[model samples]
Each structure stands twice: as structure tokens, then as C-alpha cells.
Target: MEKLQSPARDIHPDTRNGLHPVTLLNRNNLTLLDTGTSAEQFLQQKISNNIAQGHQDAFYVADLGDIKQKHWRFMKELPRVKPFYAVKCNSTNEVLQMLATLGTGFDCASMGEIDMVLRMGVPAADIVYANPCKQVSHIKYAAAHGVCKMTFDCEAELFKIAAFHPKAEMILRIATDDRDAWCALSSKYGALVEQCEDLLKTAKNLNIQVIGVSFHTGSGCKNTHSFCKAIEDARKVFEIGKKLGYQMRLLDIGGGFSGNSEFRPTFEEFADVIRQSLNQYFPNNKEVEIISEPGRYYVESAFTVALNIITKKEVYEKGADGNSRRKFSYILNDGVYGTFLDFYLVKEKQKLKPLLGKDFATEQELFPSNLWGPTCTNVDKLVNEFYLPELETGDWVIFPNMGAYSISMSTTFNGFPQPKVYFVLSKGDE
Candidate 1:
């Protein structure tokens, strides 16, 4: 709480007038933008500097200014529901610190995440262990670190919590019909509506404190009515908790809010629906604190990844119509295993395409190409159907809106290192 009380957040970014520019922000790495500087300007300069310095490794450009605006907008839109930034989305220290400085809580899903936030001077009170399923050692780590607010969905987790951390404030996580979600979590986590009563009763019998109910509408949520339905189900669980003599005081509307550049409901649209649902169900419940776990909303668009093409191969084949079908395959320094895991996981008809880092002529002949990761496996292919201008080994490919679940799920399976990050603050945030 003390760490979150910083006065630095008082300088809300310009809303009416455009951002102020900064001077002389040409350092190689980790430089903040001062007066007269913006993220776009910083991004261009950094890429040029990196190329000039032969630093062709993939990198992440974090726009702290974007995160700050997102926080301001979140507070303005969903004033009633406090946001607990989900750490698993993007655990980069800068993003976490930015949210913490702006008075947002942390929704850590594991012991490592909790340890990361705790090390940042975030009070345990400001952290919610949002993961319903956790290792016992992780549970013990949380209890020892004074993180009391954790979510649980099954009866076994209640018993374990009662035995390991009896003082834990458990929040029931119920399942939602997230059929329309791109990454539906209902299959893995969340208790059914009918099981809510039994779970609450189990906690009561074990003398465990059940503070509230929680639910996730799933990641990349496309179901417009999912949150409303989950909130409605949470209300029923709240009533059950009360009947069972548990003083439920927390309602965790879990993360599912889209923050990608993809076409999903806007934050304001989702907020409107959620606010209306909250008003209808939990109106006047001042004792109950409403909070949401939004991970991608604050960081998705805030980060842009730059990848250097490692190799290029062009193939010319004859089609059935006897026309030459020319295609290209470009190998990248990182790919589905490193930064493009989200795009890989999301099996879409037309996934997001990458932007060419180097400028090409508008009428340049584009060839159908497939992007591949720098791995020795056939499964390392990235983009299936993509058209791009002729690119060489040193060419750069930029992926904007890669801030969510991108590098967090990356691995070094093939010994290909993850992209390094360079954080920037525009509009006088330096």
C-alpha cells in the first residue's frame, strides 16, 4: 500500500492536447522518454540504433505511457471494480511496477509470481492468489509470505487450505459458459454452479473463511453475455455463502477481458455490461469489494516485438492452371516457441499478420510466404498464409499488440533465447 501511494501517478497523461515531445532519447537500451518524445519516435530510433550497432536479437519495446493511459481509462470506466493486474499475462517488472504505482493490485497465479510482486514491495494485502489450482509448496509459500486472499474451486483445495493455511481468505471460482472464448478456461478450472453450495458448505464445516466468489469468462472472451452470466452465478453463490454463515466480502470477476488488437468487445463496452450486471445483482453491497483480474488489457497493446529475419528461401512451383506459384519462407530468430505462442495457440482462419519493419514501396510485388521459427523441427512453422515483399536475412519484422501471453509462455527448448525488452515512457512520463 505504501508503495502504491506514490505521487508520480498525479501527472495523468494528456487527454485533450497531444503528448509533449522529448529531446535526445537515443541511448541503446532501457531509456525513458522525456519532454517532446513519444513511443513511436523512441521505437524507430531504437530499431535504427540496434541495426546500426549490429544488435539483431529480437527485442520488446514497452510503452509505459500506454499502460498508464490504460490504468486511467480503467479507473474512469469501471470505478466500482478495482483491477488486480494478472501477473501471468506479462510478468515484466516495468509493467507490474507501472500498475502498482497507479494503485492497482496484483493477481499472482503462482509462488514465483507472488515472490516477484512481494519483492517489488507490494503488500500481500494487495495481492490475490488468483490461481485456483496450485501446488502445496506454492500454497505454503503464499501463506508464509502473508498473501491471504486466494481463490479455490474444489473441495480438496479447501481441505488443503484449512490444513496448510487456515487463515486464508478463500474465494470460490465458478465456471462460466465460455464457449465463444478463444481460450476457454472453464474446461480446466472453475467449479460448476451446482457445486458452489457444496464447496461453500465444505469450507464452513472446515472452519475455513470463504470471503467471496470468483469466475473467469475465459481469455479472448467473445461471448458478450458471459460476464453477466458469471456475475449472476456469483450472486447465487454469494447468497449460498451467506446462508452457510460465511461473511463473503469479495467478488472477483476474473480475467477474460480482451486487450489484443483483435476484434472483441471494447473495454468500455464490457465495462458497461459488467457495471449494469453488478448494479442489478450486488447493488448496495458496500461490504463486498468488487475486483477484476485484467492482465492483457493493460499490456497487450503496450508492447511491440521486433524480430530479425535469419534466413530466406524462395520456391517456385507450377499450379494446376500451369501458372507459376511463387512462395517464400523466412526463418526468424524467434517464433511460436518464443514470442508467437498466442498466435500459434489461437487457431484462426486469418491470424494477425506481422508488419515489415523496413519500409517497402506501396506497389512492391508481394509474394505469398510462410514464416518459420529458428528451430530444427518441422512443427516450428509460424505464419501459414502471409504475403510480404522480398526480405533478406537482416530484415526486421514487427509484431504489435504482442504484450499478452506472448513471451510469458516462451521457452528455450531449442536454445533460442527469448527477446530482450526495452521500456519507454512517452508524453513526459520520464
Candidate 2:
């Protein structure tokens, strides 16, 4: 119940803009511009105009206003569970600054992320070192930065923390049913429930304070029962800590919440499941504070990518029945080695559609085309087989729900330049 003091520092200058920075193009730059439609529409129009002007590069449109709406929804639906926006999801300075102003905390995996949040004027208490296994140097960094809350799943991590950050408050990360999680982290992180008591006992013996229990049901989890099971497991761990004379006041139901269009169980539906589980498990435990690390849920829907078609080719393929078929290959400016790494990491299929042209209605012939990235590697394929109207050179392809994982996981592989981000501000956002 005490107010945690933020370290004194100068406010981030960009925060004055109250949003992420973007190349705000006016009517002269993008004549098809109209603020009335959604950001996706604006991006599509912008990309189309750029292609006509001989611009063949990939870019992203981040709607800061839309991000604010997502934050608002989280506050409305899961009021009891405070969200520490997973910084790794989309650590754009604008996004981080915006979330910080909205009073959201951060879940940082590395010292660089923790440093970024701290330098942005966020309180140390608002940041959690959520990675269960950490380098000793990072532990020293967290300790030096006053980030006392951290997670550990093994005795070795405990010894490292106790040596480098003896005063740090620790959270035991237990494994969950991550089989149904999109990115199952239990294999790498989290201690077994049976081993949790021994971990807590080890912490007690080391004179280290075990203050909370944490578990991630994995990212993009499809099963709602996963939440119930994890929460129930956390309850058992809390009792273990209590019996050991430790005050386990924090419960970090680690991130696995999803917002992908392909992901089943909508955000609201997941929230319903989580809320019910929390009520059933921790209803009378008002003294305990509950928090979550939600990476994709906050940023996924706020991003749209506009990739230009670099080149295309048509090939005749013979079937086993002796029927010849026309197969089309379209190479894009961005691929798996770049901003679309999620395809390689999680096999997530991104939705792609061409810009609807004036002649699109008249030309109704569709072709089976494979989308590939502009890389030498053949594995840079995006869409395996998508039925769409024939696309010409310089045409634009629009991908939605790309705010999370895309930018953060992008690389400079094959010498392709990273896409420039353009922040689209809705009317009255200023």
C-alpha cells in the first residue's frame, strides 16, 4: 500500500508528443490521405500511392491512439490484474513511453530492457526481471538500478542472485501446462511444482526472501484451463512459501495472453477465464497483489505492415494426373529474415491482401500464388498458397495484427533495410 518512489530524472523529451514518433506525411506526401478511415485503410492507401511513385520499400503504420484503446480495454476488463507490458513484445520507444504514461508496468527480460524502462522515468518497482535464468551481470545491473523484484526457478539462479543482489526479492517460477501454448517456454524456464518447495527452502536457507510465485502458460495459449491450472499451482506454491515463513505477496500470472486473429478465444474471452480463475483461487487474499505480463494482447492489433512486391514469376507445373497448372511466385521486400520472423519462430501465418484497386472488381480472375521474402534462401516463404488476383510489380500487400514480435524480432539479414515506422495519429489524438 506504500507509494514507490521513482528515481529523479529528466522526463523523456518525446513524451511531450504523447505518442510514438512516426513520419507523419501530409496531403502533399500522400494525396489519398483521409483521417476518417481506420489506420489500416490509411496504410493501404499510403503504400499504393508510394508504389505508384516508384517507392518499393516496406514500412509499418503504428496507431498510437489504437494502442491507448487496448490499454483502456485491459484496465476495464481485468481491473484487478495490473499489466506489466512485456517490453520484449514491441519495445518501440513511443510504445513504451505511451504505456508508461498510461500507468502500466514493464516485464523486462534483460538488463537493456530494464535500463530502457528506468531511463524513461518509470519507477523501479514498476519493472520486474521476469526471466527466470539471468546472467550474473544482469543481476548486478538490476541490483544497481534498484529493480529488486526478480524471478528465479533454480538453486543456481538463487546463489547467483544472493551473491550479486542479496537484497533482491525473488519470485519462484513454476512450470505449467505449456503444451498448448504457442511459444511453450516451460521447456526452458520454470521449475517443477514438486521442486518448488525445495527451491523455497533453498532460498530460506540462503537467507534470501522468496516473496512471490510466477508462471507463464506460454505465449499464445489456446486453452483457458491452462490459466486455472497455473493459478491453482501458484496457490499451492504460495502456501509453500507461507509455511516457510516467507510473505509471498506477489502473484505474476506470466504472459501467454494473445490477440492474433487466428488465435482462438478472444481477449475478452481470455479475460473472462482469467478473472473467474483469480476469483475462485485468490478471492479472500486482498493483501496479495496480482499482476500479468501481456506482450501481444496490447500491441498486436495496433500495427499494420505495408510490404511492396519486389518481383514476381510464373511457372508451369505438371500434376501427377498430367494436367498442367500455372504456379505464381511473388517475392516481397520483407521476409522471415526481416520483420516477419514470427513465421519462422511460431509458424504463425500472417494475413495478406493486395490493395483493392479501381480495376479490381472488373478483373475477377484469381491465381494461386506463393508469397516469398526477398532473400536468397528458399525458406523465406511467407504464404504457401494464397488465391488472389494477379498482382503487378510495385503493387502493395497489407498485413494486419503485426504489432507484436515483428519489429522486435526483425534482423538485417540478407542486407535488407529495416522498414521505417510511420505513426498514424487519429483526429483529436493531438
Query: Could you say which candidate leads in lDDT?
Result: 1
- What is the C-alpha lDDT profile of model 2 across 41-135, one tens digit per residue? 45646655665577777888787777777788888888898999999999987778778878899999999999988887899999999998899
lDDT of all predictions, in order shown? Answer: 0.81, 0.79
The residue-by-residue lDDT of candidate 1 on 314-359, one tens digit each, is 8998889999988889999988888888778884622655776666
Single out the weakest 10-residue window by summed lDDT for candidate 2. Answer: 4-13
TM-score of each: 0.90, 0.88
Candidate 1, residue 45: lDDT: 65
| Candidate 1 residue 63 C-alpha distance from true site, Å | 0.5
lDDT of 1 at 251: 94
Any idea what lDDT model 2 has? Answer: 0.79
Residue 330 error, candidate 1, Å: 0.9
Residue 248 in candidate 1, Cα distance off native in Å: 1.6
What is the total number of backbone clashes in candidate 2?
0
